[model samples]
Target: MRIGYWWRLAATALLGLASMSQASETAEAGNLVYTSGSQGSALHLGTRLDINVQGLQAQVRVAQRFQNTSSEWVNAAYVYPLAEDSAVSGLKMLVGERVIVGEIKEKAEARKTFEAAKASGKKATLVEQQRPNLFRQEVANIAPGEIIEVHLVYSQQVIYDAGEFRLRLPTTLTPRYIPGVSRAELLGSASVHTGASGWSLPTDQVEDAHLITPAQHHNTPGRLLNPMSLNLALNAGMPLAKVNSATHKLAIEKPAGAAQGVRSIQFAAGEVSMDRDIELSWLPEPQAAPVAAQFVSQWQGERYAQLMLMPPRELAEHQVLPRELILIVDTSGSMAGNSIEQARASSLLALNQLTERDRFNVIFFSSSTHTVFEQAVAATPANLASARQAIERMRADGGTEMHSALSRAFDHDSSGEHLQQIVFVTDGSVGNESALLTLIHRCLGDARLFTVAIGSAPNRFFMRRAAEFGRGSFTEIATADQVQERMAGLLSKLQKPVVANVQIDWPQPVEAFPRTVPDLYWGEPILVTAKLPPWPSRSDARVVITGESAGKPWQRELVLSAGEAPLADVGVPVLAQRFGREKIAFLEDEAYRAGNSEQARDTVLPVALQYQLMSRFTSLVAVDKTPSRPAQVTAKDGAIANAMPAGSGMQAVGYPQTANGLLWHLLMGALALVGLLVLNSRGVVYVRTEFTAAAGRS
Candidate 1:
């Protein structure tokens, strides 16, 4: 049976208040309705996903419908997931025939505007970013029995790896572990008792803990809580050897006698459950894989091009350098279920790959850190056995203190002849990404860091960015079955020499994003977007790329012509959007190292405003001019819960509880209990028995 959204929220809030005296105990025991079981709430959440893929890029539209099933005014809040690097360009609220468009404003200003409009009983929508991959949408004064739909559109460059092009749509997110001092010391600025769907308290580490920590519901067999539908159209431009989905079952259809190779794919089943990530992959035919592919368009008297350059295969080389591998694992409460199992298995596999020439150490961390050995040890039988036992004995509990573990891994001596490689194995469920990435950037020297993301809904944003900063690569293992296959490919890349010192030369002036090209891993291609000078002559323009593999230098060049070429595709805006995202990320990294400065704003805000993207300093908001709800009616806020990620346990309830959270609830409960006891002692409420009278009568 379906329940009303506001009614459920109201009930949760009342329960929350009543349990204030026993807050810590209730939290520890997982006694609340939202935290007690794995069953999903009766709240119906409907989602529709529309995707369009255009040669290495994807444009996506997601429409979420939230309906109020009860007879009370409710304020709805939903925290959802999107690709970390997505360039969000549009947000709209659908109300009957009115389409309210959202405008970009500074985050604080936008929040203030939305709050003011909401206080005036005007219908308003606010979209705020809690993490790069996580977002919260607020809809104020939703009337009883009202149905509201929010549409969000974003664009991103697709992932190309290991000869396959892949795209992933995260339907849900795993609960993240935020580590820091207790809530009493740092303290949160927001209310902790907001009727949010997830089991978590406001923490000192993550200020918006109430916003990000959502209630998670278990999925029962044959009963899916959140229903979602997806439709995808791929215009690969070249013949496809095969198209497949790694996560869900989908049907692929190719039109008969199609002019160009366009494949239409749809979910095989109807209304699939939003539990795991939806991953789709396709491979081009052996003959169709281009050595060099280029697309060009002209805008504002300047030329722009998106180019892909595939490096020639390397010949067998005899020399192989030894490595120093540091494997770091997370044993936080969030990793208590299938995630920990997968992490352990993946670590064991990684250990087996270490040869005698390599030396390694294992660091297991949760609230604390433990290293298998004080220093890196050679991969001998006894050391491997000890490492295996340590991994086997590890359990998930406590806080997610990642900084300590990371510091230990990166603080090693740098004068060793062995190549230092740190393999971080976790769900990437930490909230402090910017701080961690900054730490990596500062401490990383001659050491490469790779991220092995485990579990169903790991934070790919952190994993991907960490790898990018560490000059390594990132891979995800969503299910136990994929551990071997995915790990093998990753191991192979690690064994090979990476292509470094890449240089791209153009005949004329050109400005490119990254401004610096990253090292290319084995089986990967160099993809670059550049703003080029206008054609010098009617003749073709030459572009050359040079890189070093092992000790050998390799170069490739392509002559690009503006005229008389049928392959020219219009790619200005998408190219521009990609460039904008790259530049913003670079600025953010800089600001994280050195505090935010006017220089960053002068460089970033203009680009962000010009590109119409939401960032740390900016937000997207929409408001209705006419007041809908009456001023007499009080407004309340509630958070929508996300479904529990598959393979995870009931540990999602507000983990890493603080003394303040527990003692506050306890004090209230103790006072209430004392009042009840006094009333009983005074005979205010008494019970009488007729036992004496019955005995006398007998």
Candidate 2:
């Protein structure tokens, strides 16, 4: 009977091979499969796949050709070929005893209920028993005739974390299976094989065979299977080797003379830990001398004098007056996950920071807008609690209609007579950044816009530009955990404007002038620096600065007398632009180079190199040839620490720590303890639990 079955299979395989050869020839000749119908149930193009199966092992090769018969360029859109139901149900990949993929679902009713829930807009959450190292989406951008190659390597098990996944390979097995072409086929069979390397154990000592199936794919009619399975044959005669339970590492010692009269032993390298250090620095160095005279000239006559305007240094010592503020929060679909959670927590923290004298309103926006308070309400406990409750109840949904949100935020009815301010918190994913800018141009007043960008990948350019256009400050909350700290720091800056509408005038023709100064947010002092023409001694340089104060105008003049001292010519404008451009370029380059490797290396590298060269403005310097390391980080703790010396319109501020780093250390220690327990159970170490009959013996 076995001989007859083998002969029958051989004949069937020969016929299949012959048909596959013809299909290959046709595919090589540039045959195309065009779109057939506009409606459903149409004969969409189909392709014949040639699969080679040998004793429970299979290799599949598919040659698909798509054509765009439509007038417009048709996207090769959706083309999915299903696998045989029974064969896939029993399939399993084995790395030791763990099944990486392919476990059939036992409960049909439960599966149907899950499918229903998923279809009904309920969240489909899947736990990762094993994670794959490379999770590739099968379909992306497929142009007409885009003959893409989709390849996958099945492994026994995989590991996963919150951000990444990992795959584990078997010791001595290459179990490859061919994916079938039928969308609905239950009865399926693959030829079985017994080779020295393919079998879980030596073929000579083969004992029992077990087939594993993917749990999610079992009995489910779907073209895509996440975890595929494999068949394994164990050696019964050979005693299962005792593996050390404490180590969590597999230990295998080969039988004597198993291979070429030599004994082989193997051990798994448990876990790996790595550390990476990042350093940031600058290019050229500037002189230590202050550029006060140069900054005065550039701001002599400007429309927004508040930006360059400076208050008395003594203001830091004085108590700031009570101000009214509005916090605009974006709770749209784009902010649905972690972003919305972070925004809510940050808003609550901001509310808590408000003093009794200050008044505030909280506005949440999705497709529509809602306010916690109609107008700015005093920072009373009752009002603040009400606002906090509203923020807590906010749910992320709907489209990102940002214009409507901004319009409501800047409406005259929302304004307060006392220091009016609007704090816009969002991930800034709106498509209409330009439109928002136009609106900001029209809404310019005493109100300043402070932006809090929340998310890993945020639209920094839009947020920064909006803040610039609205005469406010821009801040990024890089992580959900860091939202509260970053938002608080930003609010601290909005307490009072340090300088307003500052202007500078030069007596002699200065070599160059910095066109603009960075917006001086509250809690930050304003400092503008400029470069002077080559003076024949110090007497040839002088500049005048003018700006508005607390409802008043003021001016300041500085003189440079020509002397025997060495005159250092610093290009203040160039330095300022270099820093600004570098920041802007960083955001742009990161966006463009999101996933493309070659383009990022070719384009962003050169730009980053140039930025590294130009950032050295006396105070900060880049020591390494590479732009990765920053040599010295000056402390900006004091009031004047971040203040740009007279001529340079740039401030060197310290990167703030969002959360206490010490907390991470504690968390890591806990993880290490858990890892130790896992290792101990594997017999790598022994743990003793001591217990005594408490007072009975006494």
Candidate 3:
């Protein structure tokens, strides 16, 4: 009698789960079908970015305005990308006159708060991080013709290397490939985030495959979407000699009486489609170039400091060594157009750079791995010709099997006399980043890995993190024109170690991020952050950095008393936030490197909560106390689309989605309950995951 009652109760509770397929929306041109009962006019979203740069750090405010054109009420969502190191610190929702400020909360609590507000017919917003570089923002209860704007503020450090300070802002993402069997395939019963559907399902390796592999659609030239407005203000703290953008034309503003060190820049075209990221770089005055600098801030009675030090340019004498060179190329579908061309050009350049003393091999991967030679062979004329012909004939197709390629490249004997180096060229478009990074950490074995990021909008997070793990450097080549200039420099650097055995000595006891220092490459800087325990507030402390450059001991020092010159941007809160972000990243990397993520959540929670940061375990949520929608009116949910990344998959036949995120899994717990009840309350219960969709981007 008890079993019968439980069975009947389960069927009644999860009836919606059995009928969810009927609610699926038909495939609209580029709009992803993510929700049940999704109807009415199309939803639209507008974006604007305001960037402020001070010295080596930048803070950006991104506003996403969701416009509901139809008469029916709707809930809107969007998926977007930011710099990999961006520390999301603020979120606010604007409803006409009232600005609802968001508060940091545990991920589950934030979701609950948003859902409660949504059910109460109140306007609210929620922002969550899926990956370090990718985020999903949702606004609830947007009325017809209403413009609800969500403002997000994040901070990041600018890249200062090779004689310039550079920054990239991501606008669109590349659809990443998810590898592993579906949970259903492994267990005969699957757990999927049915609230949102994409081109993929949940896999064993990546439980959130549906979130990262957002649906994409063909973005024809005429029907481009997600236009953006950009504004930038630069304060170099010192006079600048040159400023320019590699991705867009800028209109430099020279206001009367403005200091030469401060400048305002705007997009010459005003508003542009969000098809790719914009990259800007600047060079400081030759006389004002800095070799060492430091920024410090305080939080909760403790002090935080970030330091940058560069070794002498002439510290290393270039010495060529016999090397075992391996060139691994990506022929994935994402590299179908200009991306493939640039990668091919880079491969050929690397092939020609190999000397007769080098033992070389070639690898190409897409869906599976392939090798030109089973083992490294002397770079003789015959081998060189064979490699050149194979590279030239490579075509882009299938999924990006990056792990297989790396395994094949690094699985050989490293005990040889030659210096072992692997040059991996790809768009870095795979979603299984932790798996690959962990693989490198385990099997690296005296082998150095260098990544050549090839694409107009490559995954910067993967490129930067992989190189850091491999104890190597990364170079980004955005176009065919940059192949020669960029590849030549990278190939040149691979010939010898720029700086190794890097170590830092602080004047006092401190806890630093990156617990371990990494090897520095040509034109690279040693950047670090730390927390200074309670101590005398003295200004005489010094930080000494030491590294081995060309078999010589190299040292540089920065006086902590000397803040940035001109006395501006010394104690900004963003510096502390940057430290918090780094610390959280360190915890994550350490946990990942250890091959276990179970403790990562608990380890990073304290830092994220104490610093009010948005992290993997924490989120930002805003709620309005007053109810704005009538109880009689029902609100439909829709996803606002993003522009397809420029020059990506130009020849691909089909595209699935182009936008942010809004999916409803009404069967959140009902299906799990049913599964348990049906199996005499002993079967595994799979709770539905959350909603999100976006490529792993810059």
Candidate 4:
């Protein structure tokens, strides 16, 4: 199947621009007016832009105000507000005139085109996109003089190295519709201001710098300018700054030879707060280890599924141990931003971990693919250095082509003497998980695969699944700060093979078994638990397990005695299998959400309810709905003894209270309304409005 075609469809749906089978129109009630405003908290040095710092949360308030601008009575549904062109700058790195890095496009059309182009061996181009990490959308209705309020809370990662930060927020009010007037008028003069410290400059300074010029005196003028670049020579030590203009935000530049320090920049447009934070630290000296290995694993049951680590180890007996390694990195357009900085750091760390005994190669794919050291190379110092240099010089410029990368990684040629392994590191933003999974199933080999996830919200699903399919492990680096340590831990796992072709069996038919056994790595102990039939009631059950050690296969057996009971007992293995199944189902639900298929979304509900499960996008809340009834009347006393009679027990109803539910409801309503409008326009259904008054003496 062509993956690109599906990608485009998904992308367009996400952007709310796709011409689906549904149509919608704006409906207003009363003289309702909605207004929103945003504020920024911090600033960055290199660029005079607001950045969300690691430990700081930014606040944004969206308020809906209702006013009787018209002399009519009416009631209406809630008004949903969406922010247009809500773009944050300064935190992004620009190439030439374009914001080359750090822009996320939610446009379905552009995404479709991009995915299509990728499949056709062409570059996926982005027409327009927004910052995916920071933005807001809200909907609500109000009666005359009634106001509803909402707050958008979020945090941003500091991407630059600097000591100061700043933010400026400017707001405006617009009406959905006017009864008499063709257009809405400005409610009042709007102003910008700062709330607290950690920033310098007052509200007036920003207004003065951003106000309209007297020479061009134009009414209803909006003046927001995207500055080409900032000049950062003058401001050195200030840790915060802001520029609040309805038309333009502050432009900051980095000066040569500036001292390193933490900085934050903020921009506020009415009720929206956009920030960019910079964390500056002195670059540390390069360090290398002769050989090292590390392992990390969470407990599954009484035993463990080991994630093995070994820089180097001697082979035991006649075991056939072969080595394989694959390196996959994202060179997509988004990665063109500070992502390159982190990628280079991680690549270099991986190279340092290789030893002379191992064989490995590097694969860099974006719109295309490139390999270093020509095929797989020996882990000699000369080859390692060359590989390191090649990765450091790598640049980000292309759309993601994940399928091709995986296919090539699994097809790498390996000698039979060493164990095979693949290390995949990426931001994981592609929309073709199914296709990748199919390829993984086809390419299953003795080789294990490890995944290193990069970026703020990298695709955890892909990382975890890829590792599981390849029989390896997965790790993540949330920021550039954690790249080194995370990479080091992953590399250390390749030293030795812990267990090979391990299997377990019981003398009598076992009641329960683990769906799959965890692969044992070097330096890790083996632990397995199984359930036997009720003890004492049945003969002592014996269990047997076997696996290859060195060149010979080994076996072990155990007998358990238990008394038979009237009630069934839960075994460790049974519980482990149940947990594994639940986890797998959760991952599938996540994939469905990301795919955005109506069928998939619908299917998740039943499974979720069956599991009594709550995922990242779902929650189950219980509500009591007991009706209150009037007290019973006694004929003799003609007085009430009790206020109310006992009613049916409180009923519990399951209600979905997540963003997904809200989206589903909105989509359904829009579809129904579109259908009604179509019929009315076609003369199939007649629609009319009439006003009637009750008879009264005037």
Best-fitting candidate, scored by TM-score:
3
Better of 3 and 4 by TM-score: 3
Candidate 1 C-alpha lDDT tens digits along 12-86: 344455543222222211111122222222234678889999888898999988766545556666778888888
TM-score per candidate, in order? 0.85, 0.39, 0.87, 0.42
For each candidate, the alpha-carbon lDDT, in order, equals 0.71, 0.37, 0.74, 0.36
Candidates sorted by lDDT, best first? 3, 1, 2, 4
Q: What is the lDDT of residue 2 in candidate 1?
A: 14
Q: How close is candidate 3 to the true structure, as a TM-score?
A: 0.87
Candidate 3 C-alpha lDDT tens digits along 423-443: 989888877888999998898
Q: Which should have the higher lDDT, number 3 or number 4?
A: 3
Query: Candidate 2 has what TM-score?
Result: 0.39
Which is the winner by lDDT between candidate 1 and candidate 4?
1
| Model 1 vs. true fold: TM | 0.85
**Can you tell me which runs of candidate 2 are displaced by over 4 Å?**
1-319, 414-416, 507-519, 522-698
Cα RMSD for candidates in order: 10.2, 29.1, 7.4, 23.1
- Model 1 pairs whose backbones collide: 4-70, 20-665, 21-665, 21-669, 38-218, 197-215, 198-214, 198-215, 199-654, 200-654
In the range 1-698, model 4's lDDT, one tens digit per residue, is 12222233233233332322221111111111111111110101011222232211122222222222222211111211111111211112121233222222223433454434333332112222111221212111111232222222112111111111222121211100000110101111111110000001111111111111000001112422111122112222223333122223433333355433223232223212111111222221123111221111222212212111221233453343335566777665435455567778887787776667678788898666788856788888888887787787787655466777888887787678767778787766443454565567567576778778665334455566667667777666655667876576566555545455767665555433233655645433333323333334455445555666554565555454332222233222222333332343444534543543234434544433332322222321111122111123110000000000011011110001011111222243345446555766888743432111010000
320 Cα displacement, candidate 4 (Å): 9.7
Total backbone clashes of candidate 3, pairs 3 or more residues apart or in separate chains: 11
